[model samples]
Target: MHDHARGLSSGAHRRPLAVSLALTAAVFAVQVAGAILTGSLALLADAAHMMTDAAALVVALFASTVAARPADERRTYGYQRAEVLGALVNGVVLIVLCVWIAVEAVGRLSAEAEAEIAGGWMLAVAAAGLVANLVAAWLLRHAQKQSMNVRGAYLEVLGDLLGSVAVIVASAVILLTGWTRADAIASLAIAVFIVPRAIGLLREVFSVLAESAPRGTAVADIRAHILGAPGVRDVHDVHVWQLTRGAPVFTAHVVVDREVLDGGGAAALLTNLQECLADHFDVAHSTFQFEAVGHEDRHNAHR
Candidate 1:
């Protein structure tokens, strides 16, 4: 049996996300100017990704706020899924941004004409961007653990953080060795780092959109456990899924012995079944349709 239950931590996700958004917006402004002045493709790429990060963070913040509203009659589950949609949108933006960066880096690498970069300007702006990314990482670190919306934001900032480091290294290289190719190389490397993480995020977002069962949860195991409860003869139509990150919900048709139904033990049996899911599977929200063994099979029955 699981000893402790898990729940969404409230009011904290927004703080870090909002702080990160402000910092990212500031860095993007500086980096765009730096990119133009320094003529560094790597700086330009990092700045571009930061643009997406800022936009994505705004969506995530809005979703988190909307997700907190209580469920109403017209919208039974409320707006909790706003976070999921935000995550999907963020993932799509990351992929599109990555592709653009990759294309530009390839063009730069293949160009015949070479351009001299202002390494000093590139390095200064990149360092500042790196610092901002670090601050963003620290602020959002805890929130990412329980919230997919925050995790999407965290991953974007993390990718930009790595992009900043790559820009700084390229700038330093060009400063010392006159290696203009380092700029393109660093941009390509940044794309490399971003693609895989973006793919992973898209997979998770797609899972939620598809309404698939939460990863690592076995429906067969859950069925067997339900059947093991006292007076339970069968369990069917067992469905388990996450309403969101850290929240698992279950529903099933549980058939019981007719004697148990007639003997006034149905309430106790229902409690046992609900507890089974709660204690063993960490499924706090469960609904079981209990019926006598023969009742469910009686197709001739009328309402």
Candidate 2:
């Protein structure tokens, strides 16, 4: 028996991502203006990060729409993997954006002296950005857990939120103490926050693209669980993996006792294996290939 349930629906992420894109676009404009007016590296870095956020949100929205499509003859898995592709793109963007900020910030720090910036204006714009980022992050908090695409979007927003905080702090230091280098320092700090998040997202996205087992699942543990099923003598060719966030596919070949196969116990055994995977491993879609000892060997040996 094979239970083939579809992956989770990503319709829930559309609204939150739309709201985030609108707010992030607004912030990006404001931050760009602030960066230009004040010549603040911290503001510029935040602006750049927000630009990536806008792009990420757009990708996330597209992925959500396509992922909701039904399976077709040409593409039996539907469009669910679109979310992973979106996540991978977002992660790569984050990495590139962060590295760009780091290099620019380093140049500014190594200069003979920091350029004069309009500290007061920087402070006001950063304050506004901080508020907008907070709202965007909150909106996507719940959806992030349900979809990898949403989670990537949330990480972008969250990184920007931190960047905004750094900008505000740097702007205030420059305003009160006339320490202009604080701008570059804050830019570096923002890069620090962005790198780790980008790396984590990339690892997960790559894992999915590679069709590797999810980090949370252990193949050995699954094999053991299947072997423990009644009337199952051995298990082999066991494979467990996911296409995306919630669509797990498990396939295994089980070698059962000859007595069980001859006594019409095959149906009962199939039910038990399916139920085991569902109850213990949260694996909803599974295929069990049953065999009676030497029967499988001879059946395939001739082929």
Top candidate by TM-score? 2
Instruction: State every prediction's TM-score relative to the real structure.
Output: 0.91, 0.92
lDDT of 1: 0.84
Ten-residue stretch with the least lDDT total in model 1: 1-10
Candidate 1, residue 245: Cα displacement in angstroms equals: 2.3
Over 63-163, each residue of candidate 1 has an lDDT whose tens digit, in order, gives 89998887799987667678888888888998898888889988988899877799999999999999999999899898887778888889999999999
lDDT, candidate 2, 207-289, per-residue tens: 88787887788888888887888888887777777777767788888889999999999999888878878887888579888
Show where candidate 2 strays beyond 4 Å: 5-9, 258-264, 297-303
User: Which window of ten consecutive residues has the lowest lDDT sum in model 2?
Assistant: 294-303
Best candidate (score: lDDT)? 2
True-vs-predicted CA distance for residue 114, candidate 1, Å? 1.7
Model 1 residue pairs with clashes: none
lDDT of 2: 0.87
